[model samples]
Target: MAGGLNLGNHDIGVLAETTVPGSVRPGETISERPVDITLTMPELLRESTVTLLGGQAAEGASTDAAITLTTGGQTSTVAIPNLSSPRTDIPQQAGSPWLIPATGTVPAITVPAYAADSVALGMPKDFSIDATIHTKTTTLPAELTCGGPESLDLGSIPVSGDPVTEPTTGPTTPPTDGPTTPPTDGPTAEPTDGPTAEPTAEPTDEPGTIPVELVGSDIVAPGDTLTFSFADEWIAKKVSFELRSKPIDLGTRTVSVSGEASVRIPTDAPEGSHTVRVLSSSGELIASVPIEIEAADASDVDDTDDDYWSDDVLASAGGPGAGIAVLGGVLLLAGVAVMTLRRRAGRS
Candidate 1:
């Protein structure tokens, strides 16, 4: 009966307690027996190559038994082997162990059933076992389903509630109301009257004798005192005084020998019928007068002051000095024909 089971770092003992003597004896005089013992430390004895188990020995009696181990302060012994009992009920080879390597001071095996059966068997009983090793977990690959062919033409794509057209052939329906009725055979008719026959009067070119006149045949409206006397045969030749109108030629002058000339009409000149030609010092086609030009009449100033005299001397003296008395009666009949030819040549 030794006692001390601390186990905080080892200290335990319960070395022996035997029973199994008469096997099931429940009578006569063995009333002080109580053998329900248990002790264990094997997780294979935390191996160093271990094996130890022992218990039945009674035939010749010396069946070995001892087990002690201490780690880190080194102490170890184990030898508990020997067993044989089970005559005809077969089930006994239970004692075989022997690991001994402790030389002198052994005392550290405390296996109060390896700490009460590893705390009632949840398992680690003093463990330090090792060897499951294994390793392989990596995986990842497999994925291919297979898809491709929809390159395009998704039903001509326009579908989001479609409706958008606007082209029924070129410039669409806007040209209908035309050609109302304007071709009744093109240029109708409504013009006829019969006598437009007076345009046949074309015999004009008759204007030559411009024997000069207009020293004032009537003018005044910002007037310019006119003059122009010609006709002694255009005053002996160096003549050049133009001023025609009927299709204008209005200017040119240079004829002087008392052929007395002048011209001024341009108070913006155009009052109508005008002509004044007389050209000749080689510019020939000599004469034209036709005057009219109206617009000015302060009582016409008596024909612009009788145009200053010589109407061919008042038509050969029908008025001014009677034209010198008809030129002295034609020189008195040329002296009475030279006195009758000198009396007929003195009667020859």
Candidate 2:
């Protein structure tokens, strides 16, 4: 169903699968197994006069089932050699009514037995089909809907065998055919789709040049550690970081093997319209990144000594507060003398 465009009769579906009994003994050789491989078509599929053909498999694999198709008139039989790489070639025939198995059903199937190492899995895990397959599947002269090939995915079911005896070692027998413990990362070893043709990163930039990434965020304040990721070509190379507005060397740093490094901005870095420059080998400028070194906020510096007046003038400067404190002290002494004079007059 993964590749179905549903162009043809959407109802025309085929669920071809095989079922096994509840138990299968591990590590045991089997006789010529008689398994029921069924092709369950939608009831509406019987309306179209097309024969559901059998299959052909890829090399190195053996899968077989006897398949019979009937249109309203004559009956024909075909063989699905291997369900592993299941494929069926439906030959075009003129004047033959589309077929369904007898009474719109498939008869029971008899499969060849497999030796210990060469058993066919009841459920074919890799049910793959390509577009060209539809040239045969839609061979019906009367049927029309999808004009293109649709890979008919007949879904899967379990296999039948002797119940496995309890195992002392690993799984008694490796599974015959199924997905691996962890599925492969890709269909093939290498990727067919290479790196993106164009990206904003280093690969798409100037040749011999690497990228400069601002770690965490682009916005930062003075005294904060600024992290950067650059091209691996500069790994282990020393680079000088400088404030770009009339350049001041922040410091020199060695790029890490991972093409990344960090430098802390100085507390005294100037506040202005700004950018930072990175110079390779500690001197010659290579690139500049715009930055804004903001001015210190009100709470950043201590103002506790504001009330002190002393020869350390920069710290304790002149203001109306000093004169105001002296004036208040004199007024307090005069008020106390006036109250004493009034009390002496009252006692006389």
Candidate 3:
């Protein structure tokens, strides 16, 4: 172990245990014990007259944000320095030795290190390595500090009472029931003023006219006159009668007490059911009756049809002149026989 008092080109001061010598077995073996090294330095040292010419130190902290370092009753507040610069050299004041003994027994010796919950350097390892070579990377304060002036004494202060709210006259209580009557301030309706409309008269049916219906039997002979009676013929004159397309104007006549009327069926009218309509002067249908005419018998009229002489009839009759001659010969024979009888009677 070599203790160095470095202040020249290397550093202001450095103490390291470069190697440790001991006996070991021939085979590869792990050492279970850690070698402890003690480091000592003066409390103060003079600045070197040999001017150290090199790159400048890293810039100070970019932020004024205060950081707290606390160890037991001591606490310190400081701003974290900027780490972007190429150099970081913090000369530590020599005081108590921060003894970093290797933890327990290990397979091999490792560099001793010190860590505490109260202290942390924000600078990264590469930043510290790139920093200007110095005796120490971190500086130790004379004592630990924290917070603004009196932050550590916060727990001593008593919790204050709940804030008292002042009373006010503003309306906060809800009404027990809603307001009663409807508001009368709304607009009023105005009455309409214009011409009064006249009431229309109801239509009345004309008197002296009534619904008429024809009543009669269903059958009528060929030349027979068809009689039809009205059921409700009310006061009308000159009702024109129609049988199919033929019209029989019953000129001007009042309805009889029996309300009966007659129209003749023509002899030549084809026998079938004929619709008879009685229309009033106003062209309104007063009555309708269906009359069926019986078919005329064939023998009812003179048979003017002659029998047609076919060839067979003519042959049976010996034609025309032969039949006439045969009739004449018979007549002559009958006359001669009468004369012979008369002669015979006379002789007797």
Per residue, candidate 3 scores C-alpha lDDT tens digits across 1-348 of 001111111111111121222211212122333222121212221111011212112211111222233333444443222212222332333343222111112234211122122222111111011111222232111100001211122111111223334477867986658567667786676655864675558646566644554455667665555555555433213355677646544322223334554555666676777777777768888767777878866676434322212223436768756543332221100111101000011100
Q: Which candidate leads in lDDT?
A: 2
Model 2 TM-score, all chains together: 0.27
Q: Could you tell which candidate, 2 or 3, scores higher by TM-score? A: 2
Candidate ordering by lDDT (highest first): 2, 3, 1
TM-score of each: 0.17, 0.27, 0.23
Residue 65 in candidate 1, Cα distance off native in Å: 99
Q: What would the per-residue lDDT of candidate 2 be over residues 1-348, giving only the tens digit for each residue?
A: 111111121222222333332322333322332222322222222222123211111111111223332322333343333332233322234432222221122333332222121222222211121111233223211111211114322221123565344468778887778565777677855565877565555554556655576667556666666777787666645577877677677765546445665666667777766777888873677677777777657576545543132224423434556433332221100111101000011100
lDDT, model 2: 0.38
Off by over 4 Å in 2: 1-209, 297-348
- Model 1 agreement with the true structure over 1-348: per-residue lDDT tens digits: 001110111111111222312211111121222222112222222221111111111111111222233323343333222211111111123333211111111122222211210111011111100011111221111111011112211111011222233458677567768785766875586666876566657766766665767565643342344566776555423344444554544344433434655555554566766666667657876667666666766675455432423245447548656644433221100111101000011100
Q: Is candidate 1 or candidate 2 better by lDDT?
A: 2
Of 1 and 2, the candidate ranking higher by TM-score = 2
Alpha carbon lDDT of each predicted model = 0.31, 0.38, 0.32
| Steric clash pairs (candidate 3) | 6-12, 75-144, 75-145, 75-146, 76-144, 76-145, 76-146, 87-131
